[model samples]
Target: MTTYSRRAPRTLLLALSAAAVASTLSAVPAATAATAVPTLTWEPCASTGGPTDQECAELPVPLDYRYPGGRQLTLAVSRLRSDRPEARRGTLLVIAGGPGSSGVQRLTQKAAALRKEMKGAYDIVSLDPRGVGGSTTASCGLDEGDRDLVTLRSWPAPDGGIADNLARSRRVADACARNGGAVLRSFTTANEVRDIDRFRQALGEEKLSAWGISYGTYVGAVYAQKFPRHTDRWVLDSSGDPDPSRVARGWLANMSAGADSRFPDFAAWAADPAREDAGLRLARRPEDVRAVVLGLAAELDRRPKASDRPGRPLTGNRLRQALQGALYSDSAFPQVARLIQQAQDPAATPVLTPDIAGALSDQVAAVTMGVVCNDVRWPAAPASSYARAVAADRVRYPLTAGMPVNVTPCAFWKGAPVEKPTRITGRGPSNILMVQSLRDPSTPYFGALRMREALGDRARLVTVEHGGHGVYLGNGNACGDREVTRFLTTGVRPGRDTYCAD
Candidate 1:
C-alpha cells in the first residue's frame, strides 16, 4: 500500500539525489554520531527525461550508523537548482513514498511542476534510500512466483483460509534472512534518518526543508524528532499513524477502513451515466455498484475466469486487489469497471492490472519487506490469533476481506529491531505542516488524525475534503495546493487546522 508510482493521483500498488560540499556535524545523541561528509560532485543526470537542468550525484553513507567509519554504501542523489538564485533561501528535500521508492526518480518526475510552484524559492533535492534505484542494493532472492503482488500482499485463500499465507510468510522470512545480509538489515527507518542527516551535512547546509509523502512522512517525522535543530519548514503529505509501537503494522491494518471510506467515490463514478458511453458502467444506481462488485468477486471465488494473461487467471482475490488499487484514484475507475464488465461476460477475457500480471523485481520485494519488517517488531502470536482477527475484519470491512490483518513476512521475520521505532511527539520545532485527504485508501484520514494528535501543537493539519492518496499537486484541488504552497513559499502556516473543500 505504500508503493510509489507517477500514475495520476499517485497510485498505491505495491510495486514495488545530491550535492556536496562540507558542513560541521551538529552535536546530537551519540547513537547518531557524526560521520565524515563526502564531497558531492554533480554531473548531468543520465536520464534524458525530466527537467533538463536536473543534476545527479552520489553520497557515501555508513552501512551501519553505530560504526560510521566501517562499511560504506552509495546513495544516489539528484538536484534541480533554483533558476532565480536571488529568491533561493535553502534546499528543499523531496522525501519519496515507499521504503523502496527512488527519491532520485521522484525528483525527476515532479521537478518541472515543483519548479513552477516554488518560483525559484529553493533548490529542490532528493535521494534514493539504500536498496532503491541507483543506490547500493540487496536482494532476498525470492522465487518469481512469490514476488507477485497478490502473493506478496498476503491475500487469504478463496475460502478465507490463511494456511497458504502462513507458509508464504515463513518462506519469505527465511529467504530474506538467508540471502539478505547486513545491507538489507540496515534498511530500517532509523538508518534512513541517519542517511538523510548525512546527506544534509554533505550539502554544506545547516538545515533542510522537506516535502515528505506517504512513508516519506514517517521518515521525515523521525528525522525531525532525531535531529530537531536541522529541520526547516517540513511538510508531511498523506501520512500514516506515527505510533511507534505499531509503525508499519498499524498502517497496514488501517487500510481496511481506508478502503471502505474511499470506495463510495469510485462507486459514484462507476455508476454515473457518463461511463455508459465507454461501456464501463456497472450499475444503474450508486448504491448498487457495491453489490455488483461483491457479487462478481464472489462468483470468481466459485469459478475462476480465464484472463488476458495465459498462466494467470482472474481469481476472486485478484479482482479484490485491483479494486483496492483502483480506489486510490478516479483515473483508474474506467479500467477496473471495464475489467468487471469483461468478467461478467463468459466470452470475454478479463485483463489483469499490471501489478497482478507479473512479479516484482527481487530488489523491490527485498526493500519493501526489509524496511517494514526491520522498523519494528511484529507480534509473535500463534496463527490462530491472526485467523480470528482476519475473520472479524472480513465481516466488519468486506472491501479489504481481512487482507490488512493477514500474516506477513514480518510475523516470522528474523532478529530484533536494531533500535526501537522513533516515537513522533510534539517535542520538536513547531514547523510541521500535514495535508491529508478525507478518504485516502492507503493512509486514511483517521490515521492521519492519530499522527496529528501525537504531534500536538508542533503541527497543524490541512484536511482536504477529497478522496485519493496524495493531496497537494495530486487531486488538483486549488484550495489544498494553495495552503501548502503558501506555507512553503512564505513560511506562513494557517493560524489553526483548516479544511479545503473538494
Candidate 2:
C-alpha cells in the first residue's frame, strides 16, 4: 500500500534533554511496576486480512503507566517466525512510522520481503501503538468537513494568510478537548516506547533488534535510550531531527526545506517526453516547471475550477498540497500531473483521489492531529508570529507555500502534556544504524544529518543519493537495503558513516 506515516510527546516527563533521557533509562518503570502485563497468546492471524504466516496476539498494558493497576490497553501485535530455526537469535521489531500508522499491517506487507532478505536471522514482529490500529481506540468526533488532507495539514489560504488555519486550530483543539479522552491523551512517543518494551517482555526476548522509519525512527531512538541493554541492532530510516524542544512542530516546519529539496526530481520527471503524450507535461524545460506549477496555483486561487465534487471546487492550496504529496514518490507524479492538466481546462472537471478528494474519518483526523499536538507544547505566540512565519516561508519555499510554518491545532490545544518528550542522545550503545535519502521530500537529508549529529558516536549513517521518503527494501536502492540488512543480520556496521550512490 506504500503506507507512509506522517509522524509526534509531554509533563511526568515534560522537556527531554540529552542528560535527562540518559538518566531516565536507568529508571524506566518495570513491566510490573504495580500490575504485571498479561502473557500473550498467539494465534493464526490470516483472518485479519494480513500475511498467512503471521501470528497475532493481544498484549495488555496499563492505560496510564503511572496508574499500573488501572484500566488496560490491548495492543495488537503480530509476528512471522523465522523459517531457519538454527539462525534465529532474537526478535526484529518493525517500528512502523506514523502516530496513526498500523504496525501489524506494516509487518504484514513487508514480512515476506524481510524474511527473504535476512534469511530468517530473527522473527519479524510489530505492534499497533496505543490509539492506533487494533489497539485501544479513541476519537475527537471531528466534523467531516475538517478531515480534508489540505485542511488537516494546515495549508495556508490564498494571499498567504493563516487566519483560516488559526481558526481551524481552535476548532480542532476544541473538538479534541471536548471528546478525546485519556486514550487519545496517552498517544505519545514515550508511551509507545514503553509499549515496545512490554511487547519485548511478552516475547521473552533478552534483546530485540529494530527497524524504524520516519516517525518510527524517533520511537526507536527513545526505546534504545530508555532501555539500552534491552536493545540489539537498530536501524533508523528516513529520520527527522529528534529535537525535544519542538518535536512534531519541528518536523512539520521542516517540510518547507524537505519539499524544496525534492521538487526538482518531480519537475524533471514532469518535463519528460513520455509525459507529453499523456498531456501531463508541465514544461519544455525543468526550470520552467516551477513557474508553471506556481502559476497554476495562483490561477486556481483567483478562480477555483469546478471539480467532480458538487459545490466543492478545487482550490489553489488543495492543488499545492496534492503536489507536495505527489513529490514523495516518482510513481505518484502522473496523478498530480493529470490533476494539473485537467484543472487547466476551464470546462474539464478535476477528479480528486480518495486521499485528497474526501474527508477522513473522525478517528483518523483526531488521531493525526492529536498525536502531534500532544507530543509537545506548541508556542502560544501571538497570531502575528504565525502570520509572519507563513508569509516568509511562502516566499522562501514556493513548493510548500507557507503551510509548513502555518498554525496547527497544537497552537490552541487545551490538553497539557502529562510528561516531557525524550531527547535522543549518544549516551546509549553504538548499535544504531541510520539510512537516509539524499533528496527526501518529507524527512529530507539535512534533518536526518542533524539527527546523525545528535546521536554522535552512538550511530553510523548510510546516505543514499536518491529521491524518496523511505529507504531499505521499498526504494529498490540495493545499496541502502544491503547495508541495513547486513547490520540487522550480522551486527556489522561500517567503520564510519558512508554514502550509497543512486
Candidate 3:
C-alpha cells in the first residue's frame, strides 16, 4: 500500500507540446483581460493551526480558465513574513507533498524548521489546493467501508488475487463520478500550478522562489517550465520520476524498489540488541528479522487476528501496508515491531495508528484520488493483466507484495484528462535544485535521478546518503538542507551533481 506520500501508475509515454502548453498557461487568461489584480486582505488567521506569526488570506481565481471570470473558487493561503525585513529578497512558496496535503497545515508544521533555515531571507507562503483544507471541497460520498487505507489502496486478496481490488476500484470510481461533481475534478497538478501563478500575481511579486515536496515537486517543475522567467529560486524535494507517459503509475512502481532498498536499515535496527530494552527486537540477526516478518505476515494471511479497533481485524495485507508505511522513517520501526509483538501473542490485542484505525473522510479520499486519476489516462487493462502483475510482484517483492502494482480507482475513473500531462525537458532556465534521499519508499532516489535527467543542465541533484522521502528540512540531512538553504539565499548551486553522506 502507498504511504501518505502519494503515487500514480503506468508509463504510457506522451510527448506533449511543451511550447504550446507553456504559452497558453503562463499567466491569467485573456478572458480576464485587464482585470485588475485582486488585492489581499491579510488578517490574523482564525485558527491556531500555524505559528503566532502566521497570517491567513483568501484568493479568488477562475474555477476553470476557459471561463476565467464566469465562476470563482477561493484558495486558502498563509504566510510567515521574514523576520529580517532588510535581508528579505522575495517570497518563497512551500508546496506540500500530497495530492491532498493542505498547504496551510504544512506551513504550520514546518514553520519553525523553515524559520531557522530561511533566516528571514524570504517570506514563506503556502495555500491549500482547491478541494483541500480551508479551501472549497468536494466529496465522492464514498461509503466508510471503502475509505480504509488498505481497502482504498487496491491491495490484493489474501490469496494473491486482485478480484477484490478490481471490484473496489470500480465501486470507488463510480461513487466519485456520481457524487464528486466539479470541485473534485478540479484537483489536478496542472490546475495547482495554474493556481500558483495566480497567487504570485495576487501577492504582487514579480517572481517566486519555491520548495515543492513529493507531488508538489511535479507542480514546481511544471511551473518552472511554463513560466521560466517567473522563477527566482526553485527547489524540488523528494521528487518522483517525471515520466510523462506514466506519471503517478511510475511513482507507484518505483516504491517497490524503494522498499527493498530501505528495509535493510529497519531490519538491522530491529535485530540490534539496542531494541531489546524497548521490547522491539524481532530477531538477533538482520536476515532473520526479514524472515520473521515475512513468516508472520504469511501466517496472518491464513488466519487474521483481532485488533484493538472494533470490527477491524489485523490481516496479512494490513501488516504489509503497515510495514510499507513504517519503512518511510526509522522512527516508525518501534510501532510496527510492537504491532508484530502484539500479533504474535494469541491473547494480546494489537494496537493501530490513527492512519490504520480511522478511514479518511470521503472528501479527503476523493481529493487524494482525484489528482492522480485526473493527471493522466489509465489503460483498460483486463483483470487477467492485474492478476499476472499481482502474482509476479508477490513472488519477487515480499515487502510490498503486489499492492504497488495492483489495480486502483484510476483504472475505473470516469473522465478523460483535461489536458495531456506535461512532458518535462531541459527547456527551463538553470534555476532548479533537487534534494533527494538515497532510499525514499514513496519517491525513490533512482526516480529522482530521472527528474534530474529531465531537467538536464537546468537542475542539480544533491543526493543525501540516507533513507526516507522529502529530504530537505526533513530526515535531518544537514548536508542536503544546507545546500538547499544556500541555493535559496545566494542563487548558487553545485556546478556538477554531488552527494551528501549520512
Q: Which candidate should be chosen as best, given lDDT against the real structure?
A: 1
User: What C-alpha lDDT, on a 0 to 100 scale, does residue 125 get in candidate 3?
Assistant: 95
- Better candidate number, 1 or 3, judged by lDDT: 1
Model 1, 314-431: lDDT tens digits are: 9889999999988877778888998999999988889998767778899999999999999999998899999999999999998888999999999999999978898888998899
Model 1 stretches astray by more than 4 angstroms? 1-34, 46-48
Model 3: per-residue Cα lDDT over 61-120, one tens digit each: 767765565678899999988899777878899999788889999999999889888887
The per-prediction tally of clashing pairs is 6, 11, 7
Residue 176 of model 3, lDDT score: 94
State candidate 1's TM-score.
0.93
Give the TM-scores of the predictions, in the order they appear. 0.93, 0.92, 0.93
Residue pairs with colliding backbones in model 3 are 8-248, 8-249, 9-248, 9-249, 10-246, 10-249, 12-245
Clashing pairs for predicted structure model 1, backbone only: 17-76, 17-77, 17-78, 17-127, 18-77, 18-78
Runs of candidate 2 with Cα error greater than 4 angstroms are 1-32, 47-50
Query: For residues 233-341, what per-residue lDDT tens digits would candidate 2 score against the true structure?
Result: 9999999988899988988889899988889888899999888888889889998899999999999999998789886788898888888888777778899899988
Error of 1 at 356 (Å): 1.4
